[model samples]
Each structure stands twice: as structure tokens, then as C-alpha cells.
Target: MSLLESWDRGEHTAETLRGTTATYATYRKGSGPGVVVIHEIPGLTPDVIAFGEEVVAAGFTVVMPHLFGRPEAGLSPLAVAGAMRQVCVSREFTKLATGETSPVAGWLRSLARELHTELGGPGVGALGMCFTGGFALAMMVDESVAAPVLCQPSVPFVPGRRRGADLNLSPADLGVVRERAAAGCQVLGLQYAGDPLTGTRFDTLAGEIGDAFLRVDLPGRRHSTVTTHRQQEAVDRVLAFFTERLS
Candidate 1:
């Protein structure tokens, strides 16, 4: 069955956030801690929602943030791609969305704080993907972040351009996250074997963060499949990692 079919059958709860009013599907099963699942470039599509459900089944309250917000809400991958193209084509909108004020990392921090206090009140884990993968590490500056999983994080897409690139985290911000790692919070990362945008470069960065970094190398896997096809394995690993750390 298609992922959306399962989603519509009441397998998971379709809900909207109070502040953003952006719709997201949530799955709550286990009871120890909370986790926030960040969506990819295509937003919160079916597979990503399914991964969240799988994590809930593994014993945690999972919150999947609706990153694209209301405008292209509930869109499919193709639709999101088209919308994103338009957003990128307009340089002003792209800068506005990726700028420091509306940064992807800041929004994730908001969700983490809410999950820590309002939703579960028992600490939280973060899972970020593709363009959002680095967010989990960035969130560690806040102590509430207990565990983080980055699956083929696609920001910092090119080499050499990383230092001053839009998607690249500044050296100062990286330093703060490094401090968090030094304090012993674990950060996990995943990337496909051959994907250029997130391959060795991400590995190098993960190494710099030191012993708290756990890198998952998926052989013969590409970026999209890591989310779409092999999701069960991905979700299983994520839940296991979170359970080990958060519980």
C-alpha cells in the first residue's frame, strides 16, 4: 500500500500546530521520551511521515514538523519540487527563507523546546534529513536535545564553497555545537555511499565533532532511497539509537 493510504486509515494522527497552523502527522506509542522528525527538501511527504510512525511504534512520541508551512501544504514530492524551484528562482525569496532570521535551525529549536516542556516534558531527540540534517547538531546548543540523527544531510552541498555558503553553518555556530558535543551529547549521522552532496565532506565534519559522532554508511544507497525505499531500516536504526541514548 502507498504510504498515504496508511496515513489516512487512522494509523497516525493528522494534526496542526497551534502557532504555525501547519499540518503534520504525529504518531505516539512508547512513553519514555520525545522526538522531533525534520522533513526533507520535499517537505513532510508520505515516507517521512511513515518513518515518524515507525519511531512511535518503537516507543516514543514523535513530532514531524511541517517545514514548508501553509502555502504548499500537503503537497507531493513533485509539487514541492516545483514550488521550491520557484522559491529558488526568485533570489529574494531564497535568501529570505535561508537567511539567519528564518533559518532552518532556529525553527527546529522552537520545536525542540516545545517538545521538551509542552508535549512530553521528558527531553527530546531530533532527526533531520537531506537539507535539514545539520539541524540536529545545531540544536544541541540547547541542552534539551538528547539525541540527534542526520540522514544524508544535504546542506553544505558543495565542497570549498562550504565556508561562506548559504547552507553552511558559520564557524562560530559550529563552535557552539562542538562545545555541546564536548559535554557528551551523542550525534548520529547517515549518508549514502555515492551521493556527492553529502558524501565525504559530511564525514569530515562529523569527525571534527569528535567521539559523540556516530556515522552510518549505507552501501549502494542513494539520497532519495535512503528516505523512500529503505525507510524501515532507517527508522529501526533511528529508534534504536534514540532509545539507547534517551532512555
Candidate 2:
């Protein structure tokens, strides 16, 4: 059977949201405080959807956006290649660029604002993975995002210290993020301690945000902390963070 079958049709309510920067379809499920679960590279693979479902079950309304790649596509070399091509050429993402936030982050922050307005909670959570990892931090510039979870944020993609340590933020946006952190907005980060894709951004985050950044440096070099790799401890930590911050 195709891994796409993993998306249970009857469970999620699909809707399209048009933002200032972009328009995309979203799958929403559960009911409580809201959390925007951004997928990893290669699109919304079955693993990513499964993780969203798990987040839903943990008592929050989860919205999974179809960003790039074939929706419900499984992770294959071809699919990954195709997605990388799109990201590389698209202005919505900042692949090898430094000191600039991806343009798509504005759209995501709009989505979070709408969710928070609808749910009327303390705030909404933004969970970004892999290529979209630094997005959660960018979205934190908006007040709607109170809980930001960054899992293996690989961006400004290139070798060397400049690209490796870039936080994928412009100078102005980085100031806002620092203010948010200082104001007690806890940013959750989970990754394999030695994952090269994650680079030294974790160290950058620590230096920029200090004690406000909650660090979860797991063992080994496996990339995806909550989706493809799907660590139970990491998931638990994520859920606990959402509950503490958003609930």
C-alpha cells in the first residue's frame, strides 16, 4: 500500500488560506489551543502527517500546511530532489542566503494569527522542521506565536561558518526575536547533537536567546527529531512544551 494512505480522510478538515505572501491548503484536526506543524523537506510525507496526528491526539488543534512537493507524497530520492529544486529556485525560501528571513514566514505568521484569533488562547505554537526549521523563530517576531519549536533547522544552506551559523533572520527580525525571548517566550529546539544539517545554529540560538532557548540535543546524527526519526522522548518534550506554553 502507498504510504499516502496513512492520511486518514475522515479525521482532518481541509481548508485553503490565502495570505499576503502565499496561499496554501491546510489540514486541521482536533480542538484546543492551536499549533501550526510545518512539514520537513519532500513535502507532507506520511511520517509528517502521522506526527501531526500525534500532536492532535495530545489535545491541540493542529494545522499542517501543504508547502512544497506533492501533498501526501512519500519520501523517496526523486521526491526529495524535486522538493529541493523548488526550494532552491523559489523566493519563498532562503536556501543559501544569510541574514534574511524566508518570505514565506510572513504567510505563516498570518496563519498563526488567524488560528490564535479563532482559538483565543494564550497564543499559538509554530513547529517547523528541517528546511522550514528556522521559520518558527521568524514567526516569533509576531505576537501570535508564543510557542516556537525548531527541529533540525537547516537553512542558508552551504558550507563554512557564515552559512552554518546563520539564524536565517535579517537584522531587524533578529532583534524582535531577541526581545521575544527576553520577554519570556520559550523557544524549543530539538536535534541530533552532531547533525551537520543543523550546523552551529543551535549554538547561535543559545548565544542570542540565552536561557530562554530550551535545548534538547539528543544523541547521534539522525536528522528528524519528531517526524522521520520520531523519537518518543522528543515528542514528549514537544508536547510538554506546547501544553506549558500554549495551553
Candidate 3:
């Protein structure tokens, strides 16, 4: 059997989330508070969906947006490369630039607002991984996004020292995010200490958000926290953060 076939599964329904400027196909499952799971550069693969299922099992509505790649495509080198190429040229993502939020973040914020309106909670949760990781922080400018989790956020490609610490947010957006953090909204971040792609963004987050940033820095070169690298402690921490914030 395929590795995906052996994992825990949940019933999910697919829907189109119509945003102000874009539309996304979203897979949703479970119930309670809403949590949007933004996949990495390679799209919404099986492992990403499995992580979403874990969120659902934790008693929250999990929405996985199909950013790129085949939804059920397992981890394949070719698939990852294709998705990376697409992201590199797509106007939606800010691939090799600093001090700018990706255009898709606005759409994600819209999705979160709509979900919060429909689900009726204190606010919604957002978890972004890899290329999309800092997006959750960008969404935090809006009060509707209460729980923001960034995992291995790599953007502007981390080619230099400045890009390494850039949060991929515009000045105005960063200012608002800082204000929100000061207002008592905590942000959770997870990453391996030795991952080059992540750079020193965690330090930037800590410096900007002060005590409101809770960082879980694992020791190693592993990248993906919930998959690939697969740190159970990180996964547990994420679940606990969600439960504490979303519940």
C-alpha cells in the first residue's frame, strides 16, 4: 500500500473559496474553530493533508488550500521541482524579494475572515509552512487571525543576510503585525536550527514581537517540521498551541 493509505484519514469536502482578487480550491474537514493550513512550495501533498487531518482530529475545522501541485501527489522530486518553478514565476508569490508580502496573503486573510464569520469564534487560526510560512504572520495584521503559526518560513530565497531576517511583509503590514503582537496575540514558530532556507527569521520574529513570539527551535538540518523531518514534539506543540488559542 502507498504510505498515504496507511495514515489516519478524515472525511473532507472540497469547495471554492472566492476571494476579492483570487479563487482557491479548499479542502475542509472536522469541526469547531476554523484553522487554515497553507501548504509549502510543493503544494498540497499527502503528507500536508495528513497534517491537516491531525488538526481536524484535534477538534478544529481544517481547511487546506490548494496553492500548487496535485492534492494527493506523494513526495516526488519532480513534483517538488515543478511546483518550485511555478512559484518562482507566479506573480502571487514574492520569491526572491524582501520587504514585501506575497499577493496571495490578502486572499488568505479573506478566507480566514470568511471562515471566522461563518464558524463564529474568537478568531481563526492559520498555519503556513515553508514558502507560505510567513504568510500567517502577515495575516496577523487583521484581528480576525488570532493564532498564527509559522513553520520553516523560507522566502526571498534567503540568499543574503538581509533576506534571511526579512519577514516578507511590507512596512505598513509589519507595523500592524507588531501592534497586534504588542496587544497580546502570540505567534508560534517552529524550525530546525541548522536549516539554511529558514535563515535567521526566527530571531527577527523574536526581536519584533518580543515576548509574544513562542519559538520551538529543534536541533538539526531538517526542514519540514510536521512532515519530512517529522518532529513529534513540534507537532504536539502545534496542536497544543491551537488548542490553547483556538479553543
Please name the candidate that would achieve the greatest lDDT relative to the true structure. Answer: 2
For candidate 3, write residues 16-119 as lDDT tens digits.
Answer: 22233566677777799999999986887778877887888989988777778876877799898999888877778898788898888887887888889999
Ten contiguous residues with the weakest lDDT in model 2: 10-19
What are the candidates' C-alpha RMSDs? 5.7, 3.5, 3.8
TM-score of each: 0.74, 0.92, 0.91
For model 2, residues 116-182, the per-residue Cα lDDT tens digits are 9999979999999999999999999999999999999999885878999999999999999999999
- As a whole number from 0 to 100, the lDDT of residue 182 in candidate 3 is 89
Runs in model 3 lying further than 4 Å from the true structure: 1-20
- Estimate, for each residue in 48-103, the C-alpha lDDT of model 1 and write its tens digit: 76666677777787766555523224446666776577536632122322223124
Which candidate achieves the best TM-score against the true structure? 2
lDDT of each: 0.61, 0.87, 0.85
The reply for model 2, stretches above 4 Å from the true place, is 1-20
Lowest summed lDDT across 10 adjacent residues in model 1 is found at 9-18
Better of 1 and 2 by TM-score: 2
